[model samples]
Structure formats: structure tokens, C-alpha cells
Target: MTGSTRILVTGHNGYIGSVMVPLLQCAGYEVVGLDTGYFRGCTLGASTTSVPAISKDLRAIEPSDLAGIEAVIHLAALSNDPIGNLNPNWTREINAEGTVRLAEMAKAAGVRRFLFSSSCIMYGMSEASVVDETAPLAPQTEYARSKVVAEEALRAMADDRFSPVYCRNGTVYGFSPRMRFDTVLNNFMGSAFTTGRVEVHSDGTPWRPVVHVEDVARYFRLMLEAPRGDVHNEAFNMGVDSLNLQVREIAEIAAEAVPGAQLVLMPQPGADQRTYRADFTKFSRTFPNFEFRWTARKGAQDLYQALCSIALRHEDFTDKRFTRLRWLNHLLETRALDDNLHWQIEQQNVA
Candidate 1:
């Protein structure tokens, strides 16, 4: 893939996608977006970049949608554990089944490179001190299981002609047009910025590998343009070793970013204890020159500034549009989307 290559980025209207699309466009790729538009009006500040987009569901993707596309960056999904827990079958059908369906069509359409945006959460409650690409996957949630299942199915579809590369990402955080405050760092930052308080429900001992959203986009572009032999059918843990921070440390960073902010930790029963420290040795060795630009402190500060610019209120911080599960539930309650997560009204392609 090169500047001249035509790439289809699914979930272009999403949190990472909203940021990634503009970066990709500026880098000179001919980009086309395909999204179900669940977060169509979920912009936090300004709207996302407008590109040629297929406003259709992942399950409803057609062969014609793949025409002239040389590569595919698969990102569309239910996107989080809460949303997955809301309906496990929806996650399976969209994240797992919808992915395989897209890959099958992309392969049939002569699309060569398929970059699956996977998550490191698939290494559920990892017993390993440092989970790498080769670590045994122990998915503990519907969302994690969906990613595992999707990666396995994609691996089976990999061939000489259709190369499938999995970029398993850490907890991504930063400001974007389609902003999400549900992520760890972003959530903390939002709470601190809006209410001048950062709350941690867990024991704050769980390890989480965090990465900035811009670096994620840059790394994806690198993977897209790298030599096919270097990334073919490969899985790379997409972050640096230094990014592995504990929940308490992250909370401290967020609180420190906001002046006069308070930090509170209230450990309760069944609080999220999923912990994973990702080893990015493979990604580091593969892309030796590539550097992770933003640290957690830097990202938290950046988000703090962005939130201040918007004058984010308590209501905005708690807005359903910024949380995937709550937003989908809103759609369902308002009859904008059905129980199966499909749009109830007609959708038109955006250019």
C-alpha cells in the first residue's frame, strides 16, 4: 500500500477512525469510509473529516462496496465490554461474523491487505506478567471473545494473495472528533476536567497498557505500507513497554493534569480487575525506527486542554453519545436502532 493505494477504512466515523481518517488523507491515501452511523452525531467538538463513505451496516456490506479498494482496515464493531454485555450475540454477529464476511468479500474482490484492528483485551485476566502476540488467549468477556473469534477466522482466511495482519491495540486514549470518554485515561481525564474529581472503583492494582490515539493511527499506516513479507498473517502488540501503567498511576496522572482535582478510590466487590501488561518487543523489533510519541501524562494533559476548550460540563461528561453502550441504548429507546442494532430508518451514502 502506498499514497496511490485505495483503502477502505471501516468505522471511519468511530473514535480512532475519526482521527485516523484525516491523518491517512493528509498522508495521501485515497480513503473511503464505511460505517453503520451509530455515532453519526456523536461529535464532541468539531465534526470528523468528510470522505466518500458507504453509510451501511457491517452485516449489510456488499461486493460492490469493495470495488477499487486495495486494502481494508476493519474497525467497525460493538466496540466495548458493556455494549457486548448488552447483547453478546450482537457482538458475535457484528464483530466476529461481520468481520469474516467482510474479509471473504475483500478477498473475492482482489483486495490484498486486510488490517484487522484487534484488541489486547483478548488476553483476558492474563496470568502472564507480560502478554505478547504468542501468549495464550484467555478471553473472559463477550467483547474479548468476539475479538479472539474474529482473529482466528481471519487467520484461516489468510493466503498468499489475501494477507491478513492483526494489530492488537492497548487501551487507546486521546482527543478526537468522535470522542469517547469511556476509555480509561479519557474517562479519568473527563471526570477530572468536568467535576474536578477522578474516581477509581477498582482496587487500582490492575495493569493496563495505554497508547495515544495518534500513535495508533501512525502505526496502522506503517503496517499498511510495510513490505507484505514483514506483516503477512502477523499479530503485533501495538504499544511500548513503558506504557504499561497501573490503574492508580493512571488516575494520578489524570488528577495531576487537572489543577484542584480530587482523587477517590472506592474498591468494591466484582469491580473490574482485568489486568494485562503487553510486550511490544515484536512491534519494536519490526519497526525499529518507529517511536511512540505520547506518554500517559502527555495524553492526559492533552485531553485536559481539549476538554477545557470545549468547556465540558458534567452533563457532557456523562453524555450517552460519548459512551458506546449508553449511546446504543439511547438509539434503541428512541427507536433509531432496533434490538439487533440495525438502523430503523433509511441511510444514504455520504460523500
Candidate 2:
């Protein structure tokens, strides 16, 4: 975990991974990235800091891919619910089965540390005020179910030598090189900045424990450096308890960040009403010294400054590259990626 240990980060070209890889490198880790390059062109203001990478789909990861890698931070997946709803089987195959396969390969390759980038959305819609790590997983969507299934699979694979830690993160929001406007807070900020209006589609009452991307990266590093006994087969809600906010509060903050932005609540039926307030006491207890650097309002301001600096346009906010579902559909419709989400070999030749 120290002395410049080599680590492989899956989904390195992704929203969180784009920020995390460079952060790990700066923190003195020898980092390599593994991604299918699906979102390679999904750049916002600048490109992600490049690293030694393998451009192969996670489902197709071979034993050779684990060679010389001491640890694996698995982040590659279908990502969100809408994307999972597009095709449930794809989410199952790539997120659930693919994760098990990668973990097995890592274990066989003598990789001691396996950090699974899990989600708090696995807790699902709960009438309860707050749910902790031990709460029953009620995954309403295929995407959330995939994470729960993957975590269960990993729990069975843990042993003395192999430590699999699940960092169940909240809905993450913050600026990255590959900015995404899909998550609630990010979407609000983008809408506010580009159009001077933040729209809340589902009554704006759903509770979401939002976390900053930089804080997420910092906590992942803490997990990477922690002793095996401390993190082995453990799941921690990866944020502070205080960061939890209602959707309306997030939108209000987003609107406040932009000078003339307005907030609108347009409750619609069939909208995503899944809500959960994560209890992060375990995270605080585990890493007592680790401090969260950004609050939701501060993060909104940071995102606003970044968006304004780039002159983010209405067209930019609606671009296919930043939205996971739209970009995947574009790939499918244009025959860039196959139905299984792998790139067509002949497409490059045609181009």
C-alpha cells in the first residue's frame, strides 16, 4: 500500500476514475488504467490526465491484465439506473458477472487488495430516515441490484490474503475532466449554469447523500493504505452524515451558484423517486482522521465556476457525450459498439 505500489484502476476514463487516477498518481502510487475507451471522447473542458492503460472491455479482461498489479479498484460498470433500464441483461453481465470474473483474476494473480466501487443506491427507496451499512438492500433497479449482487459475490471471495473492500458511495457530484450531468446535483448545476434554471422532476423531496468527487478519491486512497484486517470484507458508506440533502436543497444551492438562475419543481409520474439517506458513522469510525473537504453548496459553487469558465452552452449540457444512456444509444444506433457494448472491430476500418 506504500512505496509507490502499482495499482490498476478500472473505468479510468470514466467520470470518477478520470479524477481518481491522477489523484492516486499525485499521492505517490504507480497507477495504470483499464477501460474500454467508451467515453474517450466524452471530454468537457480538458482531457483526463493520461496513464498507462489497457483499452479492453471489463467483460473481456484476461489473466494477463492482472499481471504485476498489486491491487484493483473496480469502477467499470453500466454506471446508473436509466442506463441499466435500457437493457437489464447488459448491466447484469457487465456489472455483476464481470466484477466476479475480475476479482477472481485479481486473486489468482496475487493481488491482495480489491476495492469495489459500490453505490448507496443499493439501499433503495426507504421510508426510514437513515440507513446504515447493515440495512437490507432493496435494489429497485437492475443497476442497484448489480452492485448488491457484486458485493455479495465479493464477500464470498474474501480470505486472509485477499481483502475485498466495498466503498458504497453516495450520489457523487463535483467537477472532473470528464464532467457528467446525469446525477442529481451535477444535473442541477449544469441546468442552472447553462439555462439559468434548475428543474426538479420528482417533487424535489427525495433524500440523497451527495459526496464530492475529490473527497471520494481521498477516501479510496485511505482504503488503499489501511491495514488488511481493518478493511477486509468490509463495507463503508463513503461520505459524511452531514452531506445528506433533499433534492430541493441541492437545486436551491445550484440556483444560488448561478447569478440569475431559478428553481422549478415539475413533479412527474414514473420519475425516479428512489431515495436513501446513508449513515456514514462507520466511515468516520474507521478513518477517524480523514476529513471531507467539500460540502454540497461548496461543490455546487465549484461546479458553477468551472462551467462558467468554459462558457458551458445549452447544447453542451444536452450533448450525448456527457450523458451515459444517450452516448451508449448513439454507439448502438451508429454501430460503433455492439449490443454487448463492445466496439465493432470493423468500425475503425470504416472510419
Candidate 3:
């Protein structure tokens, strides 16, 4: 690939996509954003920076859709545990199958680099342990399992024209133009503002590795430019070692960022079970000298400022529009799938 080669970013309007488009453009790379604009046409546009954009979904992607694209950065998906939990079948269809489809299309179009925005949550909240890339993956959610499947499928390609890189992102925190209110740190910060207390439904024992969204996007940019042979068929865990925090500690950071915000821990939710601290040495080994810049405190502070800037009230949280249950309800109401919306699978099928 030549300098300033064209790159196609799927989900280019998402939380990380919005930030990455500019970073790539500023670094002298031509960017083409491919998105269906699911988040209200909010995905980032090259028009905003030096890159141009194409509005298209993954399944309908044509050869022309990827014309002149040297790399494909795949980030499109339902994008949350609650969203995945909404309809596992829908999640599987979109996240797992859709990713493989994009990879096949990219390879067909002569694209050489493929970066998948994966989740470290695939490790499953392990009890009494730390996880590395080799850690026995015990994913507990449909979303995590889908990601694992996507990883295995794409990496199976192992072709010269098609290289797959997995960025196992930690508990992502921080601000984006397309800010997500559902994330742990962002949600906590949103709750902290003008609230009685930041409630940790969990007793705050589960360990979570954290990273700033912008930094995670930076990783994508780096992988996009990396040689096909360097990171191909490899998965890199993304996050700062210092940022592996408990829910309560994250709450503490949030409280500090938002003055007078109190953090209160409660009984743990049954659905929240992953608790392993991750060793990012694998990524460190892969990249060799690359360093992460954002810490949880800096990220939490940034998210707090963004949340406080919004004029929201306590009623918003309870409102169906902003709550998980209602969001899932609305998704199901779309009748996108005919299967049971609830987690109805037998334990055998789920694994």
C-alpha cells in the first residue's frame, strides 16, 4: 500500500470511529467511512476531516463498496452487553456473521489489513484470577461469545491479501462525539452529576481493565498501517495495566471527577460475573514500543465533563428511552427477529 492509501472504516460513525477518522486523516491517510448510519447518521464522516465517506451496511457491501480500500477497520455491531442480551440470535447474526462477511468482502476487494474492534469482555468475568491472551476463555454472555466466534472465523483466513487483527478492548471509558451513555464509566459519570450517589449495583469486586475510547481508536489507526505480516492472525489486548479497576474504584474516580458525587455500592447483579484482571503483555510484546496514553482517572474525568455538560434529570434514568430494559424492549418491538427475545436458549446451545 502506498502512503495516503484509502482505508474503509465500518461503523465509522461510532464512539471510536468518530475520533479515529480525524486522527487518520491528520496523519495523511485517505479514509472512506462505510456505515448504515444506525446511530441517526451520527457516525463520523470524512467530510468532517480529510477523508470522504460511504453510507452502506456490511451485508450489502459490493466490490465497488470496497474499491480503492487498502484496509478495513470493522467496528459495526449491536455494541453492548444489554444490546446483545436483548436478542442473542440477532446479536449472533449481526456481530458474528456480519464480521465474517465483511472480511470475505474486504479480501475479495484486495484489501490487505482488517482490524476488528473486539472486547476483552470475551475473557468472561473470571473469579480469583488474572487473564492473558491464553487464559481459558470463559465468556458468560452472548455478546462475548459472538466476539470470540468472530475472532476465530476471521483469523482462520490467514491469507496474504487478508490479515485479521483483533483489538480486545478493555472497559472503554471517555468521551466521543457519538457518546455512549450505556458504558460503565460514562454511565457512572452521568449518574454522578446532580445525583444522590453513584450506585454500584455490584458489590464492586469484579475486576475490569479500562481504556479511553480515543486511545482505543488510536490502536485501530496503528493497526491499519501495520504491515500485513506483523499483526496478522493475532489478537492484542488493549488497555492500561494501571486502569484495571473495580466498579467501586471506578465510581470513586467518577465521584472525584464530578464534585459532590457520591458512590454507593449495592448487592452484585446476577448477570455481572466477569472479574479477571488482564495482562496486556501480549499486546505490549506485539507492538514492542507503543505506549498507551490515557488512564482511567483522565478518562473518567473527561466523561464526567461531557455528562455534566448535558442537561439531564434523574427522571431520565428511569425513562424507557435511557434505560436498558426499555431500550431492549424497543429493539424487540422492531420485530427484527422472530425468535424469543429473552435468554431462552438451553445451556448446551448457548455454549
lDDT of each: 0.93, 0.91, 0.73
The 10-residue segment of model 2 with minimum total lDDT is 342-351
lDDT of 3 by residue, 1-351 (tens): 434878888887666777778887777778888765555323111233434677665666777787878888888877877777766886898789988988887898888888898988888866546788777777788899999999999979867667888888887767666655577887787778757478888778778888887788778877876776668888878765787888778888888888887878777458464577988877777687677787888777766656566555666544454443454465446643234443232312321
TM-score of 1: 0.98
Q: Sorted by TM-score, highest first, which candidate order results?
A: 1, 2, 3
Instruction: Compute each candidate's TM-score over C-alphas.
Output: 0.98, 0.97, 0.86
TM-score of candidate 2 relative to the true fold:
0.97
Clashing pairs in 3: 13-43, 13-44, 46-51, 125-274, 125-275, 126-275
At residue 318, give the lDDT of candidate 3: 46
Q: Distance from true position, residue 43, model 2, in Å?
A: 0.4
Residue range 1-351, candidate 2, lDDT tens digits: 874999999999899999999889998999989988777878899667979999888989899999999999999988999999999999999999999999999999999999999999999998788999999899999999999999999999999889999999998999888888898899999898888899888888889999999998988999999988889999999988889999889999999988999999899999777789999899888889998999998888888888878889999999988898998898888888888888885433422
In terms of lDDT, model 3 sits at 0.73
lDDT of 1: 0.93
- lDDT, model 2, position 166: 99
lDDT by residue (1-351, candidate 1, tens digit) is 789789999999999999999999999999999998988888888767899999899999999999999999999988999988888999999999999999999999999999999999999998889998999999999999999999999999999899999999999999999999899999999999888889999999999999999999999999999999999999999989989999999999999999999999999999999999999999999999998999999888888888888888999889888998888888888777888888876534210
Question: Residue 210 deviation, candidate 1, in Å?
Answer: 0.7
